[model samples]
Target: MGDRVYLNVLASRFRAQLSYRTSFVLDFVAQMLGQGGELVAILVLFGRTEELGGFAAHEVLIMYGIAGVAFGIADLVIGQLDDLPRLIRTGQLDVMLLRPLSPLAQIATGDIQLRRVGRVATGLAVLVTVLSTSDIAWSFPKLLLAFTAPLVGAVIFGSVWVVACSVCFWIVDGRELANTVTYGSNMFTSYPITVYPSWLRRLLAFVIPGAFVAYYPALALLDRPDPLGAPAFLGWCAPLAALAAAGVAGLVWRFAIRHYQGTGS
Candidate 1:
């Protein structure tokens, strides 16, 4: 019942966006171009250097593809949480609290932007192109990891989105700060973490676990050892990282909601 309501609301919003066909097309193209520009930058860098952070061009593309797809899915789904400040400021959150459905669920499903599928498409194209052209050792486990990595990465990113946006309950204007975590994580994971210095790499890898989003998975798929000297098995730990992130996100969201007082607007 609750799931059905969420799905229905998402479907309605998706259809509403599609109603503006021209606007939707332009939005979709703009999203693709915006993300595609990053890919172009990666290619241009490779033109000048044989390797980036000791990674070949194709290897970095794998990271980009995974990060792009994962972030696109996260942005398409939970990205609306960025609007929490507006909801709080306008007292809309108070009305949400009176509803039977979970406020978080309502906020997540309130808007479904189908145009963001453009980013997913862009990533998928790159993933398919690279996988077909690159000389990866194909095996059952590698194939399974390839398919599952993006989904797991999406979960990790979504949890970060929730946890970061929950700060709105207190600050009510913390969207920019939250973007540093959410969008910044996406940019960080889209490249080999080796490109970053040791301190920043450690922060992304352990503190935020952004490396699990794409870097480790790409290494796993490539059957390469971690140059940072981490254990080989760390590549398979994205699911565990995602679970931990989700747990923290849930706790923080619940704590925030429990302590929330209306803005008195």
Candidate 2:
């Protein structure tokens, strides 16, 4: 697959989406409002107590910001892959298979949810708000981290999306389970991971590894020692975690393709 072809295809889709400006605006606003519900829940929780799970409101907001941007960008770029089951059921998978270009690249460009820019915008707002109000001293390294963390997070979350969608090859309606994992992790990561029960914590850290996506990276950013028993340097492991997630997702995706017997003509 030529990079230029992928870029052109993505660009064309983006232009097409722009043609429906009203629909685009409504979709964007709806997405933003959906994300707002999470912010409200956090506010209500903090209304009753000064802190939840040993994190101040601002600290939690920072973590939330990181999680938001990471999740948003990942979803923006690769979330279309989640539509695999639907395409397969509708026999559109055969069209993609007949294409000369990479089917994954085609999917990447085909169903770009421009509405997700709302989530990314909200996330940037959160990050800026927290940065202005929070007491954490900003250093050059810290600034670099703040900039790069979201990209690292995008890789991690996008990789998970890939693996989740890969399962569609085996299960016809795999979306619900995948959403449970992805959305559940998004909701769960908006606060300190330490707040969850031991089993849940272990699951996020070891199985899905959502904990490392935002929590550990935030810990490193804020210079906070682990409230949990783990060593401090683990905070710096987000990029490596992302790489691992991508590696696993790539293996799963390839395995799935090999097994994929496309829907009949």
Candidate 3:
């Protein structure tokens, strides 16, 4: 019953947004630029060499292409969904909490940036092109994992956003730190992780949960022998890692909220 009400609210808001054509065009162009930069980086790197970290130019192309699209899809659908912390700090959260619907549900469907759809379309085109040319041996399990990879990436990335927002409860201005983690992680994950130094790779593994986002699944899809020797089954850990990250974010959010209420920040 509650979900329906929130859905109605979101649907109404989405329609209202569509009524503004100028806002939509500007947003779409901006999303294109962001995704375009990512593609351009990969192209420039491949132009200098045939492969990086044992990944062929084509393979890395596929990786970035798919990763870009997957990331865009998540962003288009729920990208701005991470702004809850700013909303809370600005007292916008109070309005949300007072509603009959669950705050999370309300936030999830609160806004849809239709302009980002261009990124989504361009990304899908690249992913399909790479997959068609590549010699990846497709199977049911592999295909399932391919489809699931982007979703896992979104959840993992989104959790970082939530964790950042949660901190606003205590330090209303702590969002800068969150942006560092979220944006830094996004830029790093756009490439093959193996290309990085050992220390950096390890940092991503423990601190950011990025290894599971692209590296592990790419290993499975590409059928590349794991140079790190991670177990073959480790490739499937993306969803689990995403869930764990979200759980931790949930805890942090609760803690932050408590501090917010107590400190009145």
TM-score of each candidate structure, all chains considered together: 0.98, 0.96, 0.88
lDDT of 3 at 153: 79
Sort the candidates on TM-score, descending order: 1, 2, 3
- Clashes per candidate (backbone, < 3 Å): 0, 0, 0
**Candidate 3 global lDDT:** 0.74
lDDT of 1 at 153: 94
Local distance difference test values of all predictions, in order? 0.91, 0.85, 0.74
Pairs in steric clash, model 3: none
Which is the better candidate, 2 or 3, if ranked by TM-score?
2
* Candidate 1 structure quality by residue, lDDT tens digits, 1-265: 9999998888899889999999999999999887788899999999999999999999999999999999999999898898999999999999999999999889988877899999888988998899889999999999998998989999999999998998888887899999999999988998999999999998988888899999999998998999888888989999999999999999999999999989776
- Judged by lDDT, which candidate is best? 1
lDDT pick, better of 2 and 3: 2
- Candidate 2, 1-265: lDDT as tens digits: 4888888877888898889999999999988878777888998999999998998988898888888988889889988887888899998987887878767777877879889989888887898899788887888888888888888888888888888888788898999888877777778878898899999999887788788877888888888988887888888888889889999988998788778888865
Off by over 4 Å in 2: none
